[model samples]
Target chain A: GAGVSQSPRYKVAKRGQDVALRCDPISGHVSLFWYQQALGQGPEFLTYFQNEAQLDKSGLPSDRFFAERPEGSVSTLKIQRTQQEDSAVYLCASSPGGGTGDTQYFGPGTRLTVL
Target chain B: QQPVQSPQAVILREGEDAVINCSSSKALYSVHWYRQKHGEAPVFLMILLKGGEQKGHEKISASFNEKKQQSSLYLTASQLSYSGTYFCGTETDYKLSFGAGTTVTVRA
Candidate 1:
């Protein structure tokens, strides 16, 4: 079975540009999450979705960041006005269940560099 | 809040042992451990639910102390394959707040 995957493995954007990162979760996964990893740091939670519902966005840093899982499968994280601080690897993960203990399968991630 | 990982980094030779610790300020429902090599996504290692359960995989094991809001990962007879950044994700509700990470380097 294919694991979770993200598109545009690497993206370089100019500051102030808007970028959209895509995630394809493992088939039939019900829980999805997005995270950001800065260089030499651990992954920081960004947002999460259970099926089609955006249950938690508290981790999102600002209003410019938006995410959606319209059909309860695929998801996207969009950043408006990309900033130098936004440069990092964007990771997407999914689990079969919504339980906190469920092991999450992570995608390779999309590295975004703002110049 | 993000959990704090101890020792920041460690270096070991084959057949040595190492321990990585994670501590949080708030009570936790569960703690998840993951390892990430350079240029790769984090790989799930194990999950420790509340109640101080201990779990093991191969030579790697973990213990969760619910009362202290802390968890530790122990690697015995370490191998070069174990070299990577270890992260502990503390779950409060449904979200996981991860620690800064502990980097482990193993040499022959």
Candidate 2:
């Protein structure tokens, strides 16, 4: 089976421009999560979705960030007015069950560079 | 808050062993281990619940101590493939707080 995947492996954007990153979770996965990883640091939680409902978004850094899982499969993370500080790798993960304890499978990630 | 990992980095030789530890200040519901290489996504290694049961996968294993809010990852007879940054995620609720990460460099 295909694992979780993300599009636009690399993206370079000008500061203040808006950018969107896409993620395709494993088929039939009920839980999806997004994380942001800075260079030489651990990934920080961004948001999470259970099916079509986003269960949590507390990890989102600011109002400029938005995410959606419309059909409970594919998800997108959008950043408005990107800043140089927003330049980092965005990772998506999914698990078979909705439980938080479930093991999550990760995607290759999309590296966003804001200039 | 994020957990703390000991020994920011370690260098080892094939067939040697090493231990990576993770400690959290808050009560944890679960602890997850992941290994990530440069320019790649993190790969899940194992998960240990609050029960403190020790689990193993191949030559790698882990122990979770609920009482101490700490976990230890053991790499026995380490392989070159084990060379990567290891992160421990502590789950107090639905979200996981990951540590700074411990880099393991294994030489042949």
Candidate 3:
């Protein structure tokens, strides 16, 4: 695709259930980031991937959140034992390798609602 | 910590101008501006990396002040298409912190 693409545009799961979200970044781009945005709040960094390596994940809220980019192209974020507080929009963004001067393109994001 | 954006919401008519402000409590190395429409992800508008440089995307522009730890986005001749939420992300200490956002409504 021409831009970052995210799967499961919307998801609703009962509390304690597990859910997985996927993202396909732009081809050849070397940087990928995951963010979580709660209602009426700014997007908070969750994790960052440089190719197949998960470089930074200091922003992950807890141990229940995990993300992986095995091939460096497609990535998945998994949440275990979902809680009502986990409801939020999960956004995926990608930028070319380099630095802050580069532009990061974002996907529509997945709106997850844990019931 | 994240930055703070003023004027949580603004309403304007076509050809009007609007200004949105973002302030941080810490020194900044760069500031990034993005606009997000309803139900869509954010799109980059511009970036100000220096203390005195200004950037423009068409009639939309932004300015940064490294000393004051603040940045402002300017919109000239506002168009209906400009109605959306604007977010300012500040880069400092190797991390990017974003403001809550400012929503602008441009009417015909």
Candidate 4:
């Protein structure tokens, strides 16, 4: 079976440009999450979704970040007025269940570079 | 908050042993361990639930200490395939907070 996958494996944007990253979770996955990983650092949580509900966005760094998982499948993370600080690897993960101990399978990630 | 991982980094030869520790400030319901190589997504290694249960994968094993709010990953007879950055994600509710990560390098 295909694993979770992210589109535009690499994206370069101007500091003020807006960018949208896409994620395709594994088939039948019910839980989805987004994270940001800076160079040489751990991945920081961004947001989470269960089906079509955006359950946790507390990890989102700012109002400029927005995410949607419409129809309970594919998800997108949009950044408005991107900043140099927003440059990092955007990772998406999904688990079969929304339970506490379910293991998350990750995508290759989309590396965004702000010039 | 993000958990704290010890020893930041380690280097070992094949067939050696290494331990990576993760400590959290708050109570945890579960702990997940993952390994990521350069330019790749993290691969799930194992998960330990609240009961302080221990799980193993091949030569890798992990233990969760609920009372101490900590987890330790044990890599026995390490192989070159084990070289990567290991992250521990601690979950209190449904959301998981991951540690900074511990980088391990295995040489022949």
* Candidate with the larger TM-score of 3 and 4: 4
Q: Compared to the true structure, candidate 2 yields what TM-score?
A: 0.98
lDDT of each: 0.96, 0.96, 0.90, 0.95
Residue B93 C-alpha lDDT in model 4 = 76
- What does candidate 2's lDDT look like per residue over B3-106, in tens digits? 99998999999999999999999999999999999999999999999898999999999999999999999999999999999999998766889999999999
* Residue pairs in collision within model 1: none
The residue-level lDDT of candidate 2 at B90 comes to 96
Error of 3 at A91 (Å): 0.4
Over A24-114, each residue of candidate 3 has an lDDT whose tens digit, in order, gives 9999999898999888777888988888988889999999999999988999999999999999999999988746556678899999999
Ten residues in sequence with the least summed lDDT for candidate 4 chain B? B91-100
> Which portions of model 3 miss their true places by more than 4 Å?
none
Q: Model 2 segments beyond 4 Å from truth?
A: none
Residue B6, candidate 4: alpha-carbon lDDT: 93
Q: lDDT tens string, model 1, A1-115?
A: 9999999899999999999999999999999999999999999999999999999998899999999999999999999999999999999999999877888889999999999
What TM-score would each prediction reach against the true structure?
Answer: 0.98, 0.98, 0.96, 0.99
Query: Order the candidates by DockQ, highest first — what do you get?
Result: 4, 2, 1, 3
State the lDDT at A86 in candidate 2. 100
Q: What is the DockQ of candidate 3?
A: 0.64
Question: What is the total number of backbone clashes in candidate 2?
Answer: 0
Please state what fraction of the native interface contacts candidate 2 reproduces.
0.72
Worst 10 residues of 1 chain A by lDDT: A97-106
Model 4, position A103: C-alpha lDDT score:
88
Tell me model 1's lDDT, rounded to 2 decimals: 0.96
